[model samples]
Target: MNIPYAIPECRVAHLVERHHDHLVVPVRLDAATGCCPECGHASRSVHSRYHRQPADLPLSTSQTKLRIEVRRFYCLNPTCRRRIFAKTPTDLLAPHARRTRRLGEAQARVGLACGGAGGARLLAHLHMPASRATVLRLVTRMPMPDTPAPIRVGIDDWAIRKGSRYGTIVVDLDRHRVVDLLPDRTAPTVAGWLERHSSVALVAWDRSTEYARGASLGAPQAQQVADRWHLLTNMRQAVERWLHGAHARLRSLPLLPGSTVRPARRNRAFARSTTELEAAAQSRMRWQVVYDEVRHRHAAGKPLLAIARALGLARATVRKYASAETFPARLPHGAGPSLLDPHVAYLAGRIDEGSENAMALWREIREQGYPGTSRQVHRFVAERRTRPVRSGRKPRSAKASASEPPGSETLLPPARQLAWLLVQPTSVLNESEAAVVSRVEQDDTARAVTGLARRFTALVRAAGKGNPVADDRDAAADIEAWITKARTCEAPAIATFASGLEADIAAVRAALMEPWSSGQAEGQVNRLKLIKRQCYGRAGLNLLKRRMVLAA
Candidate 1:
């Protein structure tokens, strides 16, 4: 040591072992093994060493590689006169396999956890041979969460794709995490799942019947709370239905068929400019002429059916163009010298003279034998604030009066405008539109419309009045009464649709009474629908079910 100690070489570079049950195998061996791995034989003499290739994690800009100098041993045991064998590790994968154990696990996740096709693609991208089936296998291996009996559980269904088929999804209401996905959305399948997990105390679900059936059958003691947002949505649909029936006769009804129906391309659509428009109009005129010729022929003792057949026209289309009600609504002639009629000259003279106060003018007009109300006068005057130009281009109408030119200066009075606004719907109606409604609705149905408009206006005013909010408790009670009336209309569909909700209306009402809302959950349902569609691309039931439950 005093002279200089020679450094001893390290023989053992690394070691990797594989364990199977009670057996341990040295898959990767160090250079120096004092004792034999296959047999207990000590050796000080070095017999031989060779490189053993093993899989490793990929390195940056390089494919991963591992080389180990595994030891070869000589069993000097007289009883065991056999050659020593090189050991293989069970923890390590088989030779020639590129993937490591952990990498395989992650691949399984790509297949099992994500949507099947997506998982397949992802794994393939990662150089894994994962098919949709392989992905499905991974899903099968995942353990179902042992969700504790949640006080409030949410039940719904997600299809693999839109219109493909659906599977029941249960969520832990308290945790807001997915609990279990069932095989089908049918009553029996979902019911079986619920019966197995029977301690659920409360359930929140949509207005779907099968889920309700399953819930009623499986969790009889559970209190059901229907999604209120859905209830309100149903109410809205009902209102829209009424509106559709009420306004059915309006000419501008949006008659485009369901999105699936395609409209024939009009030649006019390709035209871009006024010249093109004129050309398109001429083409339309030509068709109109043909149609009129057929009609006149029919009217002058020739048969319509014969004329239509001779002209190669679809009989129904022929009738549509020829016999259609040419005059729908008759325009009212000279209703009056509208408060509008005076706006241009009146506001122009006043504003020109620096005496224009539309509000004051509204009152003056009301006093000056103007049949219309102050609100109408105000609205008319207010509309002219744009100070539109009177272009020297062709005049649009002979109806444009001296006082009420097509382009005129307008004035508005604050009180009069507000009065006009009170006559309109509380929602969606613009101020100008509201004013028009205020003026036009002054006829036969005006009073009823006015009463409703006023009530809504009062409600709005009260909201903005900084007045202490009166107790809406009575109002809420009245809504409940209305709800009861609405329920009577649903007794037939109620047996199916409104059953779970109806039976649980008390609980639902309680849920509604709570400050919390089911809006988010309902929104989640919609999101699920979108997800289902994207994942499955309109798949069949089994495929759809698989996609929905397994999709990421």
Candidate 2:
């Protein structure tokens, strides 16, 4: 029979013995002399021949094994480590390995694609059975790939533990591949990596002080482009901050079409119609008082730490209250419509009919297709009991019954939501959203802030259009004019944000002119997050770095 497998510089005498689902082929080495792997000395004197069995790729439907007659050679150089060495073919097989180079490589690739246990199952189906541990070992043992030096790199930070630990990922924007994953996001680490890669001509990153300082220290000649996405994000956050002070106005707007708008509460009073809302409103009023006091103390030249200790509040809380331009309301949790919404009318009717037993009320609502728990019903009845209305009188529904004046109920769109509606393109807004935005813009302060925000958005987006206007002094002049206008705006947040831009004016200008962005690095960080979650607690940074860098 023809040899099932071939080996160069060796003679294969195939004696195909198909016994019990195994294919065995015998082969012999053709070379007269074998070199000692350690000493590199060629010795023709053979000690003794031995039968060696090593697994190979499956042949047809059966597992294949190579039974080779190999000779051990004595190391001629006495200076070298004294011993007999096997005539191992470095190209065909690794020393002491039970599989061929090709087979091991295939298994490693499988391990890379499907981690550990998954890879083992896949390998078994492919007729190349291996344990999950073996597959993982193969993956870990694989060498790191050598990529060409990067020219323009994008860098961004990824959370290892959100809000606590973070690491930086660098991507080659031109090649669109991850260059390296730093262990930590710090100035020294970033600078050290960039210093080694002198070929880097540009570094694109978010407006992080560490990265900016690092790039300046390591690659002073390279142009640093602040990411445009981060710029727009900062601008949106500023708008949101400004809107926080105008939250009452937002609540007053007749935005929701079918819903009733509640009469606006004046002077932070706890005069809400419902007991639950009244409690919530009272809580807000209490916090608002604290906020006012904190600001008063700060204005009196008291330190934040001292004020925090005096008021029994955290320093961070005191600082936030002190710096806020207006009282920031903590919107009630579960602000969305409740499960009891559809059955509110039925519950209220049963209550009016003298069915005060919470259990009886819950059963009635449940039979009427209410999915909410009995606890919700109990809470609803408890609130009604606290109200001073006549016992026989009909209770108002949670939404305020139709007997109340039209527009007596309102839902406040979050400041973040309002900021997005203002900054985003008008063409994308739905009819209702467009109408609300139109009303919002009618306010003088909202109109001014919105105009500046839209202009900044356009200027940043224009960079993607390859507009020469962004590259010229015209963009600079326009941005300067916008900043000047923003500084004079009634919104303190917008003015503060403008001051920030003025401080980092150089990078802001580069963001408008340069097309390169940290977007690629952000994409890689997303991929890294996927890989991290897959292996989650099972792998360490070494394995994660290997998988991210080498797998790509």
In candidate 2, list every pair of residues with a backbone clash.
Answer: 260-409, 261-407, 261-408, 261-409, 262-408, 262-409, 262-410
- CA-lDDT, candidates in order: 0.49, 0.79
Report each candidate's C-alpha RMSD, comma-separated, in the order given.
16.5, 6.0
User: 8-40 in candidate 2: lDDT tens per residue?
Assistant: 555767667887977887778778898888878
* Best of the candidates, lDDT: 2
Error of 1 at 89 (Å): 5.2
Evaluated at residue 67, the lDDT of candidate 2 is 83
Candidate 1: tens digits of C-alpha lDDT, residues 1-552: 011111122122334233331111123343344565555677655567676554344332223334544555666766765666543333544455544455556665665445667788876555455577766665555544444566667777665444566676776667765566666788888678778877787777776667777878888887666665555444333332222222212222222223211223211111133465467668767776776676677677776588777898876555444443341111212223344454445556665665435578876656766666565544344433334324443322221233242212221112223335434355767645554444433442333334433443343334333442345564345335444544454222222223434555554554444433334445456756665554565434444344334443
- Per-candidate TM-scores read 0.46, 0.78
Regions more than 4 Å wrong, model 2: 1-11, 18-23, 36-45, 60-63, 74-85, 249-320, 323-326, 330-393, 397-412, 468-470
